[model samples]
Target: MKTPNPARRSERSRRAILSAAFDLVAEAGYAKLTVEAIAARAGVGKQTIYRWWPSKGAVFVDAVLSLSEDDTGGLSLPDTGDLRADLSGVLRAIVDEYNDPRLDAMSRALTAESLADPTLNSEITARILGPLLEVTKDRLRSAQRAGQVAADADLSVAVELLYGPIYHRWMLRTHPLTHEYADTVVEFALRALEPAH
Candidate 1:
């Protein structure tokens, strides 16, 4: 008999689990999410998820990343030459995701959970924010190399500046998120980081 392709089955299981996690979180919020529920929705045993992830938070974060497909394999900065337009386009895409109600619900749930669970807060960053920040920081370092950003720019801080305003509005509900707002944030944030000459 031909040896069954275990990798293919594993991939299918992973996709189902992630899709179930995302749908459940978007529908019920993080506070109510459980591994059991995900297993039920995924049509897999709870052991399947545990084998792949350590906790529900990890699963949820992975699920969100899967749904968002943020392209984390490398620093995904567009290099069409204009830093402003490139950054604006990146941030605008982020803003567009925020505009989606499913993502909005999931983000809100993740944010709320982070507030009450210090460990989870750290977990959230480790699973989601850490990779994203590193990629963006790498992108900023590329800009520095290209003379689009100041040589001495603190890339961590610059990356934060790019995301912080958008995160604030998204988390606090202080204002409507829009492409205009994201572009404005990119403009203002880059002003301080741009080459001094």
Candidate 2:
């Protein structure tokens, strides 16, 4: 029987700590979550967590990234040549996930933390949100190539238009995030992007 390498064991411990941190936040909210709690839940020592993550905020961000991977299944957007349908499908899926209890908890916690700390805000945006937005832009660019969207359509603006409203609704709790809302967003966005007569 060969002994496990120390480096591999350390890496596994780190992953476990991050996963446990996310689960704790999802269940108990970030305010009640602590490094000691995560260490115990992860079956690792408290020093181990402190050695890697500088603060609970860093651990929370890592956990959020992990949860996002589970949610998005790795960020390749759906592009079936029909711009409106593709955008609608993607956005609706996002809305559904955003409304889920686990995701909502994590999102709210992160939002609160971001509001308090500019560094955390920048880290989350750069690590989690930016890549997702880039994926959206890539899909819209594909639509442009297929002529479903006008050549001059601003992909960045289009992506923002598609996702901004959904985020607004989620953050504000203004209305139910339904497929119907997604459909309306797609319709208005597509019309706006259509070539001028």
Candidate 3:
């Protein structure tokens, strides 16, 4: 008789665990989510979750990422050579995403937890926000080459300029996040990044 494929079983279990984590967080919020609950929901042993993830936060990050995976499996920004338009599109999309109730709840839960756990914060940065930041930086670099952005402009800070206000407004609920607001941010960012005379 052929031996059972342990690797396949492991992958299946991992997928199940991630899905369970996502579902639980969406249904009950992050505060109510627990490793034990994930195990029960996934039909796997608690040890199975521990074997792969260091904490519930890690599993949750992975779960959220898995659900948001695109067909390209990468966070891509539009690059139509019109930097202003591209930036507007990206920021508007971000506003749209943040406007989603499920995503808003999930983001708030993760942000709250990360404040208390430095390790989880690092994991969230590396696994969730890191790729998107890198992609945005790359897009800015392309704009620099196209002479749309100042050659000496600090790309890191430039990225912040584009996203910081939106993040600030969203986190603080200072104002409603909308596409028009996103476009306004893009306008300000473009002005700040305008090529030197």
Highest-lDDT candidate = 3
Worst 10 residues of 2 by lDDT: 67-76
Candidate 3 per-residue C-alpha lDDT over 1-197 given as tens digits, one digit per residue, 9 for 90 to 100: 98999999999999999999999988988878899999999999999999999899889888877876552123458789888887887788888889999989888987987898898799888876777777889899999999889999998899899889999999999999999899999999889999877
lDDT of 2 by residue, 1-197 (tens): 99879999998998899889888888877777899999999999999999988888788778776755533434457777777777888888888778778787778886896898787788788877788888887887777777777899888888888888988988899999999998999899888887666
Output the number of the TM-score-best candidate: 3
Off by over 4 Å in 1: 1-4, 68-76
Reference-based TM-score of each model: 0.87, 0.85, 0.89
- Residue 76 error for model 1, in Å? 4.1
For candidate 3, report its TM-score. Answer: 0.89
Candidate order by TM-score, decreasing, is: 3, 1, 2
Candidate 1 vs candidate 2: the lDDT winner is 1
Better of 1 and 3 by TM-score: 3
Q: How displaced is residue 34 in candidate 2, in Å?
A: 3.5
